[model samples]
Target: MTQEPAEVFAAFRHAESLVARRRPLDALVALAPVLAAEPDAPSVHLLAGRAYLNSAQLLRAEDAFRRVLELDPSDHYARFALGKTLQRQSRLTEAQTQLRMAVAMNPLPEYQEALGEVSARIAVEGGR
Candidate 1:
């Protein structure tokens, strides 16, 4: 039987609640089935990426964020998350590029802050 979109979204919501409770493992487990069934669900991918990131699973987080980007190329949040994952992995140049793209796509204060932080780090590293 096919699940309704609303049902899928409800499962995503539950996964989000688990993340909010600091149960990222549980969130990931809960999201797994939904992700397999709806691979292109941007929001689910975004949240799964976030949960993985929170759990320090950098590669998995990157994959999830990349999937989100594939599904919604214009999603600034996914771009920002990808940038953050790159930064965490010490891929400074790539992080900077992604962060800049995110900032350009949407000049939100958070994106600007992340860009500024990445810029400062790059400058500091370059001076060393």
Candidate 2:
């Protein structure tokens, strides 16, 4: 039998609650099934990416963020998360590109801040 969308959404929310409670492992475990069933859900991918990031699983975080972008190219949150993940991995140039795209998409102050920070890091790295 097919599960209801509401059930999937509830599970996603519970995963988010786990992340909020700083139980990233639990969050990941809770989210895995939902993600497998709803791979195209951008919000689910975004939350999973965040949980992975918080757990320092950079590659998994990157994969989750990439899935979000693939499902919805215009998702600023996904772009931002991807950028942050890249930046943490020291892929400054790639991170900057993603950050720029995110800023162009939304122009939110937070995006601007992240873009500026990444740009500065790139510039500083280039100088070294």
Candidate 3:
């Protein structure tokens, strides 16, 4: 079953709206068709990752973000999201590495902030 690109993009927008409204499960549900139709699409995976992250599904979010990186290694947003997911899971070292890479790639304020936060967590948790 093939879906039109426009339809897939529309679903993505709908899912984003659902996520922004804090209805993660609903977002996931809304994204189902897009996910099925565009399994390898980085934007679809990124949106799913965000919904999962907002819902505290850390592992799922991590996988989705990783999938985006696997598809496009230069995707700084995916790196930042992966870093945040790892941070939420208390994998501070991994988070720090990803966040650093994201900041180096894009130098966005959010990426830098996440990197700083992850580094602080490592510092505190490492007892150094």
Candidate 4:
């Protein structure tokens, strides 16, 4: 049986709250049904990316964010998230590329900050 849109969204909201609470496993559980029903939804993918990131599921998070970017390259948040995921995985060069793109697209303070961090890391690693 197909679930109602409202129900799916409600679950999504619940998952979002769980993520905010640092309960990523719970968030993933909350998201599962909606994910199954709407695998291609950008919102679902974004939330899943966030949950996976918080849960330290780095590869899964990267895939989720990459899917979002593939669907909507103009999504600055997705770019930022993907950059952060790469950073967590110690892929500084890839992280910097994404962060620079995100900064050029939107110039959010957070995006700039992340870029600066990655740049600083690169400089340090180069000096070493």
Best by lDDT: 4
Worst 10-residue lDDT window, candidate 3: 119-128
TM-score of each: 0.90, 0.91, 0.92, 0.95
TM-score, cand. 2: 0.91
Return whichever of 1 and 2 wins on TM-score: 2
TM-score of 4: 0.95
Give model 1's clash tally. 0
Query: Once superposed on the true structure, which residue ranges of model 2 sit more than 4 Å away at CA?
Result: 1-4
Question: Ten consecutive residues with minimal summed lDDT in candidate 4?
Answer: 119-128
Provide the global lDDT of candidate 1 against the true structure. Answer: 0.90
lDDT of 1 by residue, 34-63 (tens): 887798789888999999999999999999
Displacement of residue 46 (Cα, Å) in model 1 is: 0.8
lDDT of 4 by residue, 17-114 (tens): 99999999999999999999998898899999999999999999999999999888899999999999999888999999999999999999999999
Estimate, for each residue in 42-96, the C-alpha lDDT of model 2 and write its tens digit: 8888999999999999999999999989999989989999999999998988998
Clashing pairs in 2: none
- What order do candidates take by lDDT, descending? 4, 3, 2, 1
Clash pairs for candidate 3: none
